[model samples]
Target: MGKRLAIAGVTGAVGQEFLQILDQRDFAFDSIKMLASKRSAGKKVTFKGKEYTIEELTEDSFGDVDIALFSCGGSRTKEFGPAAVKAGAVVVDNSSAYRMDPEVPLVVPEINAEAMKQHKGIIANPNCSTIIAIVPVWPLHKANPVKRMVVSTYQAASGAGMAAMRELEQQARQVLNGEEVTCDALKYQLAFNCYNHDSQTAPNGYNAEEMKMVNETRKIFDCPDIGISATCVRIPTLRAHCESINLEFESPITPDEVRELLSTAPGVTVMDDPENNRHPMPTDASGKDDVFVGRIRQDESVPDNCGINIWVAGDQIRKGAALNAVQIAEKLL
Candidate 1:
């Protein structure tokens, strides 16, 4: 018999991606369990031509389960994640609930698969932006440490949830029809616009998502003293999210060397050629799993060839959330 796996929040966007990735990756599993909140219980989800019924999450949910992939949210993970771990199940949690815990390994497999080996039971998937950023940056850091970075993110509505995607479509039609634009999934209309902050309200003036990038990157990169600042904005797109990154290395670097590092980095596609007006964009990356990097150049304003500017894009729902969670499961297996 193969491993038995349980998925919490099995009906949500990330859950659906988990199913897709598992099927695509051909992971071996003897049985699959679907779990959700009581409000979503009794629903049927189809995967690999088999229908699985979702049950409400409970303390005994991990019985006989070897792995649990959690995306229900932070609160649920906080309340139930430990219980699952205590029940002899390894948890690959995709929430803010445990990523920062020193005891929990905040992992991005490409960047730090070794961290997974250190897992006592729970391994946290870093924030989507953090995961994507580190995928390209970690490889560079291996050659030399990064001392400072300033990033501005153009995130997608899907990061907020499925409702945000729907809102973007509906609101776009309303705008086309000249109807009054109403905000629901996000505080402001998400279509054809951008914001400097992540959520509508940011406690202490730091958007929650921005704070995640600044903080999570530090932990995943294992650099506590690195100077990092970020601004995460919700763009109108429905799937892929992008970021404009400016990084300063601890030592001098050349564009050629930077290109060499990223060109061959696993799970990263370096598509830079500014003369050809080529760069990674959300539309080109909406469905891709690899983090696309382009627009590579030395930031002339910042000292040395050490300063670099690049664009990054990835399927926020896939690598950002579900795909990453599933990858951890595959590693555990």
Candidate 2:
């Protein structure tokens, strides 16, 4: 009720999620502006049960906005984030543009909420893949300094954008209609299929998403020397992402100790029981705020009992993007 806010890329997936979280939390805001690309301009969007017309994002869109959540893309954030700051609005950008900038804070509230206070007008939410990995890993990293990690992420098609989600849905429909599967939003048919390839394949084989998990994890944990390896795969799921994480620490870390530490950790739901065939699943985590972690056990591959294997999941659009950005904005206030 005191401040005005604007959701850039309001028509986009992350932007819509931001609006939903704000409404769900009953955030007190006097005014809400929804900004989107010109193509989506003049479209109608409803916030807090009120109909509002979406405006095309321009250099002047941030006027009188107290906070602007940017999720359009990195290029858009890089182009307009500073302008929003100049217009007197704090920007919580859900992109990689300013994440590695030494001046801009890349925050995951549980791991680095205090960093929000040091923002240079813009705070960055970590990458979706990184966000999911860190939720369950941070508490462990805090208790024991992680020496290294090797992770493989099974991401959702929705990570690409709403188009990818639609493509998967439409493709499945096509298959159901007895037609050939389409592969427009992805490199391969994502309808009831899985690809063990990176989000953006590199010459060396690792994808951009794979690198984000490695780089962003080190930055969030403040452990640049930690040896991190990652392989990111895209799955047919609509929303949530799953990660198989193997962490190695300086000392021998135990599964029991992890269970104790994570049992009450903030925003974490520990659901492990390999023998019972219980573990974190995307279906279970979808539309949820907390990150679900399970399959906790020691890894025999890493020596000294210093390694543990686990699986984790969370809604990439929520915790991995919108929710985290909103949480940071809340911290700013």
Candidate 3:
């Protein structure tokens, strides 16, 4: 029999993606519970041609749930995750609450499905940029061990949630109409411009988003010693995240060999067509399941052909958060 599933934060962006991906993948579930905050409660959502009412989330919400997919914020996850677990539900959490916990497995199913076996009750999904970067990187790492990675991300407004997406649209229209743009969802205007990620800056100068890439990449790859430097920026796109990744391998590996390796990698699609300059872009990756990889070339700065540069794009809400959590839930089944 299919498991009983509950979707927390059902009104949020990632929560909506969970419904779409589950239906797209035909995930077997006997029943589903739609949960949201008190303000979102009593709302209606349609799934698989049926409508369901959004119930207010409480500690008791998971009593009948076999698996709970949580996309609520870290605070909510911390407040409710253990309740779900104690009530006999496995939580595939998309927040950072339990990610760095030594007990919880930080999983990118494409990279480490086996790690799911180590979950005490919650399986932590890695950050969006980390997921998009490493899905394509893992295959290459298996071929030639990656010693270091320098990543620059062009993240979409969708990464900040639905309000930020609307803010981008509103700001763009306001700018074109010669009106004063108001900022609420994000810290600044995001139309026709870019800025460093809005996440708080740490004492070391890395923003929270950038640091997530550094720390989560190591945890997911199980290579704590691997060097990672990331500069994350918020672009004006609606969805999808793009990254420029410079990889230094332990030994020499050519761009052609990297392409060949990624071509067959699961959850990856090679889009390296330089002659016509058709490469991975946010527009191409939006709403897509596979992470698109392209621009495979040698990083001339590193010696002995040890460095390779590549570009990648993927739907952050899909693969990076909701879909990844669901994939871990699938492995449980």
Candidate 4:
């Protein structure tokens, strides 16, 4: 029999992708419950040719649910997660609420499906940038133990949410028409501009988004000692995120060897062809399930062929958040 499922925050961007991914993957579910905040309670959403009314997420929402995919922000997860667990439903939360919890497993199914086996009723999904970065990094790590990694990210407005995406479009049009740009979803104009990600600056001079890459990467890799540093920026792309990774391995590693490792890695695709200026880009990765990888070359600054640089891109909403949460649910089945 198919499992009974509940999707929290059904009115948000990731929630919408959750619906699309479920339909695309044909996830077996006997029934689904659409849930949202009180303001969006009566909204209508279509899934698998059937209409589902968005119901207010309350303490009583998970009575018959076997699994719940949560895309609501951290606050909601903190408020309602325990209730869902008490009601006997496993939760795959796509928020920062329970991610660092010692007992909760932070999972990216492609990299660590076994972590989900230890879930105590709730499992946390890693941050979007971490997910896109780690998918390709894990294979290389397995091949040659990585000593350190430095990453710079070009994140899309979609990572902020739907409001930011709509603002990007409006700002671009306003700029083309030579009008003053008004900022709502962000503090500055995103059209014809780029800025550091706005995910709350921390005391250590790193923003929350950048720190997520550092902390979550370690937790997911189960290598707390691995050295990692990240600089995250928000670009004007509508969807998909890109990253440039510099890896230093314990032993000498070559570009050709790294390519061979990633070629067969799950959820990764190579697009390296510098001769023709062909490589992974946000335009190509949008709406795709695989993380596109390219620009595999040696980092000349480091000696002994120990450093390799790579460029990669992936759909943040699909692989980063919603699809990852859904994949964890699939493992439960």
TM-score of every model versus the real structure: 0.96, 0.96, 0.99, 0.99
Q: Distance (Å) between predicted and true CA of 265, model 3?
A: 0.4
lDDT of 1 by residue, 1-333 (tens): 579999998888898888989899898999889999999889898999999888999988998889999998999999999899999999999999888889999988888778898898899998887777778888888898988889888888888888888889998998999998888877787777776554534657777787788888888878888888888877888888888889899888877888999989988999887888988888888767899998888888887668988789988999899988888888887
What do the candidate models score in CA lDDT, each in turn? 0.86, 0.88, 0.93, 0.94
Higher-ranked by TM-score: 1 or 4:
4
Prediction RMSDs, each to the true structure = 1.5, 1.4, 0.7, 0.7
**Candidate 3 lDDT, 111-218, residue by residue in tens:** 999988988889998989899999999999988999999999999999999899999999999999999999999889899889999898999999999899988888
For this target, which candidate reaches the highest lDDT against the unseen true structure?
A: 4
In each prediction, how many residue pairs overlap at the backbone (N, C-alpha, C within less than 3 A)?
A: 0, 2, 0, 0
lDDT of 1: 0.86
Candidate 3 lDDT (Cα, whole model)? 0.93
- Stretches of candidate 1 off by over 4 Å are 198-204
lDDT of 4 by residue, 1-333 (tens): 889999999989999999999999999999999999999999899999999899999989999999999999999999999999999999999999999898999999888899888889999999999999999999999889888999999999999889999999999999999999999987789999999988789999999998899899899999999999899999999889999999999999999999999999999999999999999999999999999999999998888999999999999999988988988999999
Clashes of 1: 0
Clashes of 3: 0
Model 2: lDDT equals 0.88
**Residue 134 of candidate 2: its Cα lDDT?**
88
88, model 3: CA deviation in Å?
0.4
